[model samples]
Target: MTYNKRICVFLWLVKGGISVVLEMLGHVKLALKCVTERERIERK
Candidate 1:
């Protein structure tokens, strides 16, 4: 029973970690996109 509980906790943490990573990736992508747009505008 304790083993099962530990497994569940481990899985939950993994899922949460994955979500945080994905969120960070999205923010980085957005920042890059903004920088690219600014550069393009400056070039024009």
Candidate 2:
């Protein structure tokens, strides 16, 4: 029973970490796109 609890905790931690990483990646992607669009407008 203790071993099963440890496994569940490990999986939960992994899932949470992945979600945080994905959220950060999405924000970075949006920021990059905004930067590119602003640069294009400046060039025009």
Candidate 3:
């Protein structure tokens, strides 16, 4: 029983961690896009 519980928790944490990482990556992409746009405007 304990082994099953531990595996369940491990899977849950892995799933949650991947989601969080993906979210952060999305935010980073947005930020990079904004910065590039701003720089382009400044150049003009």
Per-candidate TM vs. native? 0.95, 0.96, 0.93
**Which whole-number lDDT from 0 to 100 does residue 2 have in model 3?**
100
Give residue 35's lDDT in candidate 1 (0 to 100): 100
Q: lDDT at 2 for candidate 1? A: 100
Q: Given candidate 3, what's the lDDT at residue 5?
A: 100
Error of 3 at 22 (Å): 0.4
Global lDDT of each candidate: 1.00, 1.00, 1.00
Q: What's the CA error at residue 37 for candidate 2, in Å?
A: 0.4
Candidate number of the best TM-score: 2
- After superposition, candidate 1 runs with Cα above 4 Å error: none
Number of backbone collisions per candidate, in order? 0, 0, 0
lDDT of 2 by residue, 1-44 (tens): 99999999999999999999999999999999999999999999
Q: Which stretches of candidate 2 lie over 4 Å from their true place?
A: none
Residues 1-44, candidate 3: write the lDDT tens digits.
Answer: 99999999999999999999999999999999999999999999
lDDT score at residue 4, model 1, on the 0-100 scale = 100
Candidates by TM-score, descending order:
2, 1, 3
